[model samples]
Target chain A: MDVAIIKYNAGNIRSVDHALKRLGVSAEITDDPDRIKAAERVIFPGVGEAVSTMAYLRERELDKLIAGLTQPVLGICLGQQLMCQWSEEGDTSCIGIFDQPVKQFPAHELKVPHMGWNSLDRLSGELFPESLLGSYVYFVHSYYVPECEDSAAVCNYIVPFSAAMQKGNFYATQFHPEKSGGPGQEILSNFLKL
Target chain B: MLAKRIIPCLDIRNGMTVKGINFENVVDVGDPVELGAKYAQEGADELVYLDITATHEGRKLFADLVGRIAEHLNIPFTVGGGINHVSDAGILLSAGADKVSINSSAVRDPDLLDRIAGGFGNQFVVVAIDAQFKDEKWTVFVNGGRIPTDKELFSWAHEAQERGAGEILFTSMNHDGTKDGYACEALKTLSEKLSIPVIASGGAGKEDHFVEVFQEGKADAALAASIFHYNEIPIPELKSYLKQNHINIR
Candidate 1:
């Protein structure tokens, strides 16, 4: 399978590529629009600041290219955050794949970056299979998108939020499956089968 | 709520894990991929591999080992020791490392923290502080604990957090390899001072020590090498002990 991970100067791509390799799928990390457009499965994976990443994506016209992709497109971590309408991280606008805005997690006796393994429930998306319901997956994020019409899975931190969101052909996860061990591997496998 | 992490730090010397081992099937316990996979299967929340190798060839072997381990394990992995620049940090991150830790380099060029946190995001940059208590203060030590610095451990941890380091891996030189106990006093001070997570390294003699670090020391994570590597403690049993003691651990 020609799995292509959209690359535009972001972190954590290597880990994602390596995860795919473990599943026996060699994903090509590329910025070339043709390759990304022609890919059987597209993954938009990133971990970085919102404004700068969006600026780079805009500079390379990747924002529009990614939005226009018709295949099974998966967004991860920062990629999922940017897929929303806006992000409070840097007061930046992002690709409006979902009609939601990403906001920073509230500091109500909880740490800023909700960093560690957490359980997922209310799973109801192609991205999250039944087996993964109530299973633990690694999550590390400060900004989050609250539960909305597009939420496929939900988790609670300081507030109830979308752990995984899907709309039509586009799917996104607020957590990094690449770092989430066994259940994470299963999540990726399910996404691939979709 | 984020679960408290248990990290096993293994030192790499001569392109091999130098922790004395006695596994029959393991020809060389230093094999990075084998050990990493083993720890993950055993329920280690995370694993840290520190390269203490001196030879240049060993550096290449270390990178190759990281690549192999990244392919095998399905957990968060962190690498540190002798990383001097963002480019070097980039090398390990590109080799499938989730986060790259900087110690001596972070002390020399403090702004390197900003650069790394900028390039890799704060979540991907970890600043490792090796500190020793002396003269009524926990003093910062760099260059593998050979040279002492004027920076206080508390202030340095606060600085790392302000400079956007995702986490602080604090190794207490006074407690390291002693198996006495974690520097709880220092850990409590650090946890109270900094908002970022503090990973307490050194002085883990028993499973009860892990509980003390979390409940009393206020540590976000506890790290030990000797107890785990030498089979004095097993990851699963230790986690069960922590859970039994009412500590939230993955």
Candidate 2:
């Protein structure tokens, strides 16, 4: 499959590239909208602050291009957050793909960033299956998308939030499927099949 | 609820996993990559590879091995020890390292924390502090615990956080290799003082010791080497024990 990873000033796209390569699919990391739009599949993988990432995307005019793509696009971590309408981190506006605003996890007995392996249940969409229910996937973000219509999977930390979201041709995961071992590989494989 | 992490720390010397107690003993427990995969499959939340090599050649080998390991493993793996420049971290990150930890170098240039946080994200930079109790106070040690610094442990941890460390890996030099128990008192105080997650390292002999670290020490994670390496305490059994004890574990 011809896959392109959106390159911007965000978090590790290389890891996503490597993850695909592990599954025998070599993906191109490109900021050029033509390359991304032409690919059969596109991945928007990121790990950066929302405002700066949005600025990078908007400055290069890739934001508009990404919003226009009809191919299956998988967004991971910060990519998922930016796909939302807005984010509380850095108080920045986002691409509004999911029509939900991201907010910081409420202050509770648990710490922020919610780092480490957590269980993902309530599998509800094509990106995941019943096999992944109650499976432990990795998570390391403070901001989360609330339980929305786009939510494909849910994980509880400070509160139950969207672990994975699917809207039209766009599928996103607040958790890093690229780094979640075998289950992670399965999620990526499922996206590719779509 | 977030699960408390159980991390297995592997000490590498001359590209081989060695015993934490003695540097000279190059214990062929197994290749680090394979061992890391084993632990991950058996339910280890994270893995830390501490390359104790001081030579430039060893750093290259470590970086290359990290790439190979990253290809096979799908968990959060931290590459630590002997980070001289910011580019070193970049190289590792490109090679698929989730996070790069620096102790002596971060101590020398405290601003590296902010710089790394700005360049990469704060979650990608881990500040590892080795502390030894001396003169009635815990003092920071650098250069493989060979040189003692005037800086106190508590203040340095606070500074590291302010400088943009996502997490602190605090190792108790006095408790290391002893396997008695973790320095729970110090860990508790450090966790209470800092808002970031604190990973308690150094001494872990039994499963109960891990229980103590999470419950009493209040550590977000606990790291041990020989106990897990030697099979004295397998990760699956340990995790089950922790679960039985009402500790949140994956």
Interface RMSD of each: 1.5, 1.5
What does the lDDT read for residue A25 in candidate 1? Answer: 98
Q: Which candidate has the highest lDDT of all?
A: 2
Residue-by-residue lDDT tens digits, candidate 1, B124-176: 88899999988899889998888998899888888889998989999898888
Q: DockQ winner among the candidates?
A: 2
Report RMSD (Å) for each prediction in the order shown. 2.9, 1.7
Q: Classify candidate 2 by CAPRI docking class.
A: medium
Model 1, residue pairs in steric clash: B17-B30
lDDT of 1 at B84: 80
Q: A62, model 1: CA deviation in Å?
A: 1.7
What count of clashes does model 2 give? 1
List runs of model 1 lying over 4 Å from the truth.
B20-28
Against the true structure, candidate 1 has what lDDT? Answer: 0.86
Stretches off by above 4 angstroms in model 2 are B27-29
lDDT of each residue in B60-116, candidate 2, tens digit only: 888888888887777889989877787888888888888888899998988888888
